[model samples]
Target: MARLIATAEDFAFGPAGKLVTVAEELAARGHALTFAGSGTALQLAERADCWDEVVACPTDAPEFEELVGSRMAAADLLVSCVDRPSVELARKHGLPVAWLDPLTWWWGDEAPVWLPDLELCVVQRSIGAGDAAGPYQELPANHVVVGPIVRTGPERRGDAGSGPLLVNFGGGEAADWYQPGRDTNYPYVIIDLLLTQIDLTGFSQVVVASGERIAAEARRRWPDAPVSFECLGHRDFVERLSSAQAFLTVPGLEAPLEGWAAGVPTLFLPPSNSSQYVQLDEFRRRGVGDLSVHLRDFLPPLDLLSAPLRDRSERFIEQLRDFERTPTIRTEVAARLSDLLTHPEGWMPAVRRGHAYLDELGRDGLERCVAAICALVEREGESA
Candidate 1:
């Protein structure tokens, strides 16, 4: 009944993946949705069956404002995830906007100069244990606080025993703020350790996923590991994790949350960015992420949380010394993986505990936000 324009930040798959979940829900509710995204985010949205139109949201494209403004003309509401430019477009076109931010734990408390006034509803997600002890705090006003915005995960199979153990090295498609090389140095080292140090015979099969460049590197680096590296869009990736008996990956909010939502026994590797560092620590602090590892656990010199927010992973990529070469790091990682892989039934209790913990934090943020977006249009149109 309502026309919706949506977009997500191309920083990582996190925002785009979450947008897909919300968009799919809105589409199921019979709303027409148009999504604008660039790079892999656009590719990801294209894979979803929810969008009526999936246009490229390149800020530098020709007549960008005019093109986007034309699209905005037919929309009743703008839905976005952590993307400022789309919000600016909505404001300029006098459209109602609902801004979804899933990173309340990692973002600064102050709203930007161009933000706030543009938002009809700021769906600020606050998910953590009791404390907001991180460097960032929640914004003070016009907020709808709730939990993580994750789907029910893959359609969950009856035969999970046969599912392969999944290892996600996280993704590499970010804005140009990150330097070249795909941020593969740290995760590549982790994969190298898995190939050389950790034994994978416990699971029937292990599928590794990462960026194209990293997948290429994985093949080049370990040609004989009996493992093929691949990259998956959000839908395929979640479907894989949802059915997995055991999942091992980085502690980024979305992936691990999906694993937890699917009740898969998960082991988190080190953090790729600063926010990931805080998220892993928070999960551990909450006692739900004890099994998860951290960068500090392996590389002591890399104190990512202490550094500035915007400066991420470049030095880690540059000075990435012989990480798997470290005997202690190898030993620690091997032990952690082995512990997760062994007597796998024992791991589910922790996984279930994590599920309960997340539920207690709140899971209805996406539903509530979608309802708000629909209300902004459906009710107003009815009154008219």
Candidate 2:
């Protein structure tokens, strides 16, 4: 059995989705999966028999190289989400690594140099396939295009929201600048906008999910809103989201996927970060969610999202259902990894060349990639 370590470094608002899905897949295939994550992931994983060993790797801790090195020595592969340090340590110990979520390159430029030595780099889309090379380097090789990996189903028990505008900012694991900054430890902007955006006189309640600190601020901010507002966790939150009529939120990738998955119509309050603002634009282009360009765009005496809103919500729901049925990155990565591991010389160069082209031209470039993968598979088929 292959032994693998999947890292949950991106431990904010269901960051472990990728890790959990991949780890579960690998386990079912007779691989032993060990997990390294913050306390949250460990807490969540405790309910399921997902990981062989759940090591607590806090983000605040000092040099974790020794601890990681020790754990990696027993593994053959490592799959990770936004955890470069752990990936680097795994490679140093001669274990193959697959880095997930290439879209997050916004974190650091130094990622590529640390990334290249891995046996494979799995990306979310054909568009994300490329070198982590320097500011002006041509691409390197051995990247594979795989769709995003998501946990198969919701873990937080219960259905979604019943409120007219069911607003949730998710957990405090990660937050954007518009989200009252990560250090503030609350879902302020999300809560503020949801409560203030629309009239609640006829609406049942305006719900917000926040830590105690943020909840206190929300109560202080809107004393006369004439709506019910409170902070809640897993079960209640999921139930709230599932039943919600309209969702008001700041644009974050995961929650929108969840809202869409649950067939909820959501309005995105403009985000503070310019990159995210543009990304939300791209999401609109890709039919991901509904987004507002400006704050006033979603503001006071808020207009209901009309008929177009229902159509888009249903489209997003359909897409999300298809996405759930679609094969995950692990299945694609596993197939690619297994092939590359068995025939490095022949397959590696083809993957490299394919990735270089895809990175430059995006998925529109994938006609060439598909031909290449087909040709490789054909050649292997003939040989077999």
Candidate 3:
């Protein structure tokens, strides 16, 4: 059995989930798997029950490079999800490295300085193709767009007509990144504002899945609003998404891809950052989801007593005000929500298009990825 070191960015749910899926598949194939990444990655690895060992190594840690370099020296191959440290370490050790980048957001001049030996892109085309230059322009030659890396889970019954409306703003990582030092209640605030405008008479239930902090806040805010506030694991999260009737979430790559796979149309809220804004725009352009609606357009300014939180809120409002300077594109966010809720069937065309795209691209992404890893490992063994 080959010894494989898998690493990924662990701050968010998507990368951790994808890494766990890869680790599980490789472990099941009898390969020895060791995972090195952030605390989120460790948590996901523990949940997946695959890794022989897990090391919590945040990307920005001072010793992260040295730690990953040591691991790379012992591993037969490296599989990574946006873990640049691991890729750099692999390059130093001359080890084969495969990058499974689901977001495909790292391209053009913004691409990582050190390219992986193999790039498994999750999108059909590399982003910013026109701006790519020199050696970076040839980077896509090694890219294999395998679509979104969706993990297999317990078969879920499709309840598109009656399933719960899933509301998620992503995991606690996003909260920590977007509104540090504040109670993670921004998503609940968005939901509260949305409920004021949209009529949810047709939906059977509303479920809000996020971090414990957000869940607790949701429970407190919507004590009697016909909503369930519970944080679910990755498998259960996907199962829920698979059976969901609709999704209301921040514009993230994983949730939308899962929603598309489940045939659930999503209404995207304004992104918390510029990266999310880019991904959201791509989703809208692909007709996979609605364009982002700024939260400020639907809700008034937030009042926070916490100094850090208040400062963040003020900055956010300023950014929103600047973004809304263009009058022609500015509309009431509530209007879009109302339109989505009133005519859920209107999204079916987009859903069909997205599904067709997935089908054409092939849905057996994990298998293909596993096969590629095995092939790389075999080739390495032969070279040895």
Q: Return the top candidate by TM-score.
A: 1
Q: lDDT tens digits, residues 58-151, model 1?
A: 7545565766788898788888888777787778788877777777555544345655565454454444436556322544455666566777
lDDT of 2 at 280: 56
Return the TM-score for candidate 1, rounded to 2 decimals: 0.86
Q: Please identify model 3 stretches exceeding 4 Å from their true place.
A: 39-43, 63-71, 103-105, 116-137, 140-142, 151-156, 172-177, 180-185, 194-197, 216-225, 291-331, 360-362
Pairs that collide, model 1: none
Q: Each model's TM-score? A: 0.86, 0.57, 0.76
Cα displacement (Å) at residue 321, model 1 = 6.0
lDDT of 2 by residue, 248-353 (tens): 5545535554454445555554433333343455455444433333322222312222224334334433332332233452233233323322332342233233
**Candidate 2, residue 263: how far the Cα is off, in Å:** 3.1
Tell me the lDDT of model 3 at 207.
81
lDDT of each: 0.70, 0.47, 0.63
lDDT for residue 40 in candidate 2, whole number 0-100: 42
- lDDT at residue 183 of model 2 (Cα atoms): 30
Quote the lDDT for 1 in model 1.
Answer: 77
Model 3 C-alpha lDDT per residue in residues 1-384, reported as the tens digit of each score:
999888877655667777777777788899988877665555555565687887777755778767767777888888888767677767777877878876454343445755543533333232343243522244455666554566544433555476677877666454235442252334654566556756777778888776555677768777887778877776678778877777777776567666666666666777654445556555655555453465444545332222343354455545545434433323355566667766866666766776765564467777777777777788889988
Task: Give stretches of model 1 more than 4 Å off.
Answer: 60-63, 122-124, 127-129, 132-141, 153-162, 179-184, 216-225, 301-308, 312-331, 343-345, 379-384
